[model samples]
Target: MLLIGGSVLVGVFTFIYARLVCTFICSLPPAVLARTVGVLTLFHIVLRELLLRFSPLQGERSTPARRAWLLSVVSWSLTGLLAIVIHVTRYPAFPAPSHLKFAVGYWALGGGLLAQVEYLLFERALPPTPTLSPEAQLRERLGRRLIEGYVIFTSVPVLVLMLTLQRFIYELHGDLRYLLEAVVLAAGFTGGALAVAIAYGRSLRRDSEQLLEAVRRVGGGDFQPGAVTSRPDELSLVAAGINEMAGGLQLRERIREAFGRFVSPQVATEFIEKYARHGKTAVLGGSRRNVVVLFSDLRDFTRLSESLEPEVLIEVLNGYFQEMVGAIQRHGGLVDKFIGDAVLAVFGLTEGQGDPAIAAVSASLEMRRRLEAYNARLAERGLHLNSGIGIHAGEAVAGYLGSTDRLEFTVIGHTVNVASRIEGQAREPRPPLLFSEEVARRLGDAFTVKEVDTVALKGVAGEMRLLTVEGEARSVRAA
Candidate 1:
């Protein structure tokens, strides 16, 4: 469409230019039908050659080379009309003496203008640079083509122009042909340089467009990487960069989905975001804030796992954790990590920093709610896995402390250890919910909690009091 539009604009100028040149050079008689017919026939032949360029049959065989050869033929054939065309007084008959001279010059001007147009069009069709190979090379051939056409046109015309200049102006006046040669040489150089510049620009545009399209296609989910060789110039670099980015995205997506398998959907999101924000996969050996911890285990998973095949065990485990994790995350918790048969989760942690204590309690209740639903579904499938949870709130440091090469983002220190011990000590007789004195103090009286006991857990300075939340787990404590 652009090329066509450009051509239409060019035609408008060509018409105006042709009219001006015709007015001065060719004031032919109205009786001259033959001269008009001859000019029309020549143009029709040029148009025929132009149309042949689009033929699919000629594409694979040899169109460019043939086109070049045909161009040479057109120029030589016109050269043959030099003498006869000059003397054609009118079309069929000789009229006034002055009319013949005007007609010849006018016809030559028209032919020169037409040839220049064809030369430009043909040059535009070729590749811009010498280094280009077929369609793969992205050099704007137009400038190079124009340079080549000008070169071809200039080589023959320079000799003629020089001879004319010498004979009519310089030679007759006892002057030098060197002046005429110099002028001709300068014009040739200028035309060739223009051709080169146009071709170069055209090449750049073509290459850049193709590269941009490739990148956009990949962004649009084409996903078919590894076939990028068309990237010419900076485009190649861009494609390479995009391929690297896609690789990273694919890796993140893999990790994102994996979290769901080992943990619940809720936990997975927080865990993923937390790890990504801090630039670590998991953490260990640190302190955490006042938090609630949940541990879920299969009551008879050992026996069941022993009986089941490897695939069956994994399938059951994955299904079980997916439900549990989803439940925990819905209440705003993060999955710390998953051991072989147990899952560890931290609630009221990073995601709930402003009010970690309250958020932990909410998450625990939601976890229980999700577990109830999971048990019902498991009942239908004839599978059973049970879980125990422990909640405690206290000051602790959470950070990235893992292997140098492969890091894990996690929370450690006193709160994590205490939360774990509370889980191990939990019993059906005592209470399913346990919180530290610290957690109780932070929570105040929002929840109706009881001081369960003060038991000396391993590696602690003194026995820590544990509380159990009974009812009304409201967010804010009453005065």
Candidate 2:
């Protein structure tokens, strides 16, 4: 229906153009014949549209080039057929010589104009098709659009004026004055067209540079919005799309930073990467895996908090946690969470070059060293503190846990509980760091470990052997 309506409008405009500009005497029969030919052309176009729409071979194969080629064929075919019919049937019998030249040129101009209008209508009727393959070069397509604009807006009108003046020259018996008027009109139109084209080209180049810079900034992790002013054309749509992409990236960055604050940055990064890789949210569940868990607590933290003001207590805790958490992360441990002045970290969830047991023990030793430095700083403030760390390696359930709205990635099981119980045993005569029999076994000859004692832990069925690191093995120390 759109095609039919648009065709009818084109025919009406063509009729008016011919009558006002051609000024040729025509019998009713030729007019009726031209209308009949137009009706036939419309029918042909409609038939082609219907066949293409319902063709079994029509899948997702339509392309812009194919559509443009098709529109060109249809438009020019109608133009040529109508011009041939008008010239062969009406012009040969016309009496005046000037009328023949005038009518033929006017008809050719009208036919060319008709072809342009039909091409536009056909293009609208057949919109671009979606395909999985990459499209053609956008730059090439935009360049083609600029050329089309020049032909339609500048070249077509100039041709029409030239034809009109040529007919006037023939009518006035080769008048030089009308020829001069033609030259002046051509010059003025040419200058205006050049100026318009230059302005349009400059605007297009500026917008294209802005879009490229926007993409470059986004790639460099700058997610700031771009300032690209574009006319209401393809450039405007491209600008809007780039702005939306930048906004989405900026939002994701904010989410990542917020999530990292709640959990370890390593865990947060893994969660996001998994989401992207699987193209869906991760399932809420846990898996049993062999891992090493480390637990550290400040001794007499409750008593110290009671002695200091709230602000001072918070400051001390923050300072202590910063040191301990940094030590854990340096050894590839995930800082699970903090309980009051206690820190819980896990290893082996993420694959790394070092063994999980060795990494946990190494982190514990580093925490001892960092705590001594922290103690020196506290001593300067007329205060001092101490902490105990326990490490254990065993099978535990590790994954995200909690309600859908509030989930936390952590480890939970007997392994974690045993590590916490073992930390309670670290006191005055013993080293501030201790580990279970399992951790010692995994360390093997990597570090010199001494059996501390066999102690019964709370809620455990039997007594468990604990060990403390004396020093690294000779080979490890040499390395």
Error of 2 at 441 (Å): 4.1
Over 276-302, each residue of candidate 1 has an lDDT whose tens digit, in order, gives 747874654555465566665555668
For each candidate, what TM-score against the reference? 0.48, 0.63
Q: Roughly what TM-score does model 2 have, to 2 decimal places? A: 0.63
Q: Tell me the spans in candidate 2 whose CA falls farther than 4 Å from its real position.
A: 1-148, 156-184, 230-252, 270-284, 352-354, 456-463, 472-479
| Candidate number with greatest lDDT | 2
- Candidates in order have lDDT scores of 0.57, 0.72
Please state every model's RMSD to the true fold in angstroms. 15.9, 8.1
Candidate 2 lDDT over residue span 1-479, tens digit each = 65455445545554555455554533435576467547645654665566446543223444454454455445444543554555556566653432333233223433345445555664566555454232232333344456555655566567666666776776445786877888788888787877777677667766776777777788888888574766877778888888888888888778888988889988888888887435786678799999999999989887898899999989988998889989899989999999988999999988863899888888887788888899899997888888898989999999989876778888999999999999999877777888999998998878888989899999888999989988645423622
Worst 10 residues of 1 by lDDT: 97-106
Total clashing pairs for each candidate: 24, 0
Top candidate (TM-score): 2
